[model samples]
Target: MCDRMPLLGMFPSQKRSPPLTIMNLTKLHPFLLLGSFCLASLATCDTAKANDVVGPLVGAVESTSANFLYRVGESEQPLRLSVLLDGDVVQAVDSIGRQEDDFVAKFSISNLRPDTRYHYQITNTKTGETLIEADEQHAFRTANPARHGNRVSVGFVSCVDIEPNGIWKEMQGLDLDTVCLMGDTPYIDSTDLKKVRTRHREFLQMPDLAELAANTPVVGTWDDHDFGLNNGNGHNLMEGKVDTRRGFVNYRAHSQFGNGKEGVYHRVDLGMIEVFFLDPRYFSQTEPSPVDPTQPTCFGAEQWEWLLTGLRESKAPFKVLAFGAIWEDKKNFETDDMFTYWYERDALLDVVKNENIGGVVLLGGDIHVARHLIHPQRVGYDLHDFVISPGHKRTITELDVFHPSLEWSLVEGWQFLTLTADGTQAEPTLTAEFRQPDGVVNRQVKLPLASLTAVDSSKPDSGLRAHWSFDGDLKNQSVLGDRVDAVAVNDALVVTDGGVSGGALKLDRSREQFARVPRSFLDDNSNHHTVSLWFKPTSLPAHGTSERHFLLESTAEGTESAKSAWHLSLGMRSSEDASKVNLQLFTHTLQPATEIGAAPAAKAQGGFDALVDREALLGRWNHVVLAFDSSSLTLTLNDKQIAKHPLPVPGPASEFGGLIIGGHRVGAGRNFDGWIDEVSIWQGEMPAETK
Candidate 1:
């Protein structure tokens, strides 16, 4: 699945309009035509409520200062913030030049205490009129002092909907350091300034959102819908850019707003992690011609420069590059993901690799599905991309995406991702959980601090024992670089393109199958050697035809003297759901037999089963490894150790006559039906980890 494009026929978003050709917007500015309507809009706002006040919405809380955004009356005017900390009057914020601005001004309240809640309200400076009521719901707190070992948890959700949403209520009960509105806090894909500002007010005033903002600091950026229009780029919405930007800066509160001029690109530090919120849609191009030299860029020119500079200067252990689009190449007709801008993305990634920047994680939204992808050595390290999305809508189930980098993905339930950085450990770790209000976690993964650093990807650490790359012919690309005497046992295997590395061996279960490797690695003296291979399953999970979908097996087959060996396979579960596939590893500790075929007895030998989910297997090449040492044997799926079994004695492998790939030698329906590539073996130990 490395370079596969999403079929896209199965994908269609009703929220977005169809893409259009480039239009000349030089003489088509909407602001000129709508200039007269601003006054009428203000009169309409005044008649709706006589003396209305919008918010004391809180943002960008530090140990000493915090920013308060709100609106009073109808037009731009001078305003003051009345602050109270523990019933004592506090010094007002510094307003030397920004006392009188727009209706919504980001009041920077300074000289405050740390880790303390301060109650505040907005007032008119000229008339000394009280604009807001004295309510504790209008309170905000300063953050704890900045330190390396601070324990911080941040919750990120995107694509806020107009209809009722469960995540907004679910987030209020959780105590998070900060809540990020990744994009589309409200689905107002409008080009009207009046409507944009009005919708932003409604979004901030929602009961659940208002409550969460009162207690916890909020920071965010804009995506397509909120940026101007759905899939709107600079070429299409040249007129609305200024108005939409003004609305964004006036409404959303952030620690920094990218020089306070162009795009909502900023950085927010929560505990040990620093999140660089990127604006991928603000300056995006209209066309999909990624190879063109003179087309518009995704992040524009200025924003791209800022992004690279920020990454170079960051010192935090974990630097999260936040965007509104999913990082995978999955795209549709409506809009493009980061994959369309591969040149720019690769440039940014190459900077991280060449400069040796460590602990960088990519975070994105807007895919409508929760996913965890490990791009294999796109950088020097296997970069982890954790996607959070579709805060209101149910996840899109029709996207049958197959990307080599995708390790984990889910389309069930309504949830948001919570990332916590435990900075107090010897090796600080970043943990992400797919969470719901019911405390149900669909998936959870933890990354050690040292896992995201630089390493030599070309030179693997394990001592190579044998290797096979099936590109029309069996060739060993290991140190030996010799021809492997491998053959199709039944002439059913054929070379198939679209493999992870190159052409791969494809097999069909209905036909005579499996490739026989003469002089198998097990024939050597080493008993603890490891075997790993990349497999792409093509057949659907079977309910009754057979259970064991063998990928690699070296057993006695009731013919040879072998007694104890290993078999790596996919076992069908007992449940009615056929999609819930489980990865299985069967090993003969000390006993042996050929009677246990499909349903091996639970007593004869030990087996470990881990849910790999059939969705991950079909149409995608996944790295599967069996690491066995003297102490234990472990099974890995997509570089993650899923199952392990302990051995009472050493040398548990069965002494089979030879090795078989893609199927059990004697089975009719157990042969694998898909592609296989980069089959490898290591004698002593896997070099720290597999590629």
Candidate 2:
């Protein structure tokens, strides 16, 4: 072999060419020759012709066996190749079939030892010539098997484009056993294969990157950019089988990963760690109209089954699931990006919680930034979502907003992690390192595994409360007319005509106006609590055109109180046509909506044909205070509880959004129009009428 080669220390004639190019090559590498022409016998092939048919190398990937893969032709073909494992000659058949096309070939080398180093070269079996004279020698390493007494370390990275100065070099010192490639590997423009190939070359040519892959095995899964379009999901493809096969062909041929099926998803064991890689794009469903949160799904039936079976049967100490995109929150719940298959996530969470499955950590990429999310028992099971994403080599994008349970969500430079294990105990250290292309670490943060799990649930859960100043001044407090204030009268705030005035506060004159308070303000630093607000309306509207007055309001709408969970409002009329006035207090869980308060059959008095008479409030101010404890919502009129309603079972906060005060424009619905005063807010129900 040494006498026949040039790139390696084989042949004397194939000496070093300082500025080597395809045109100057004396012979085509055996791998390129086999790729260019389907010649059964490599001995008679023309090395010159092979050199002329050169293209960009793309989808450069390594398999579980640590065999490196690359695409150099229209088809992902099986190329005749020779490899040096730990500096030893290991001639093998590095061929994987080209799926869905003739021009593309899927090449892969399997059955290799773990934690081993290997150097490889591609050449034509016939003529001893190199295809790209300069790219003759490249190296890679296989992943170490997850064995007993082994402390396997791994780093995860995702979302990268072709950039000159990348952080790949600094990420190398992370001391990893496996590198999780979480998609968006290359910017496959879908329209241009050249760009795709160029992107692949950008990563391969990086000396730092080459060293990393040569030292650590890479496991991968693809997202939109690497697959084709920007947000392309399932069903997106290039024209004809030729181009369509090119995308996945390059990915499959170049990466060491292999799936039982065609899509890029698989599993591997790293001592105590077993990772389940998921490809959510393939099984995505056509987004439904009106968007339903209860039914969002990413994994199709078959994939879900496969994932479940694998999880149920795995014997590893920890199940580390690598998701290519965000799972806890869908892209756009209200529009096209909404998920239609939520059953799978729910089922998975159920299994993890109920089955007592410990050490289950979900890792995701695709948001462009890194964040750690912990979903505690707000209403369901508590779990940890440990995510770390280095979208670009130089991270500069903000991915998420402020979250109360967030451990660390930052947009700095790239990140790398080292996870060591001792039996059932695994310690993961994540380093948010800001580094340069030359391997200089600027700023770094080393987070221990305890930071990932030791969260305190002692803080009071976040709720609404009510009180009265009773200043006896009615100015600038009214919901209508700017400067309509109302002051405290004895123990209750007095409301007359303008109610409370001044301070640029205005009320809805066209309808009955009331005041509003935010539920978040009422949250008593705890997950659950009670709230109450006091209101006084001078007069209820007799005409249906006048909007109903609101003591409290929320975004959720519908006749069902369950739909509008945790809302406390007092309104007259159901819609534009309803004549009866209904006073109500409601809470919503995942259950249904329920309402408390009597509905009038006819308008109230004062020219009212149905429901209660407006005459009841025509000439006097009525004191109404609503209070909520852990179990019930009590409405008090004149210091006496008139309506006591049971609270709904605790559940997801549905129909909750921005807070609205005074009268709300209920589009073809009922609007609130009445005066409100003596609004005292607290985190919990007003001190239970002090014994």
Best by TM-score: 1
Write model 1 residue lDDT over 320-340, tens digit each, in one string: 898777765553554446654
Candidate 2, residues 1-691: lDDT per residue as tens digits?
2122223222222112222234433364555333334211111123323222222222232224534443344434445555566456664554532543333333356676665666666654344444222222245555455544445555667776544224444455555556667777655656465555445544443334544553345556776667666666554442321242254545343342334344566776764567787876654542321122333245655566667787878766556777667654332322112122333554565566445455566677666667775544321223456555564545635346433235566575454333344442355433334333345544444444344332232322211122333244423221111211232211222333344332212344343333332222222112233333334444455565544555545433221222333343445543344444556444432321121111101111111112343555444445655554534555665566666665435332222322334443231134344445455433344444421
Evaluated against the true structure, the overall lDDT of model 2 is: 0.44
> In candidate 2, what residue range of length 10 has the lowest lDDT sum?
596-605
lDDT of all predictions? 0.64, 0.44
Clashing pairs in 1: 562-655, 564-653, 564-654, 565-654
User: Which candidate has the top score in lDDT?
Assistant: 1
What are the RMSDs of all candidates, in order?
A: 19.2, 12.7
lDDT of 2 at 12: 28
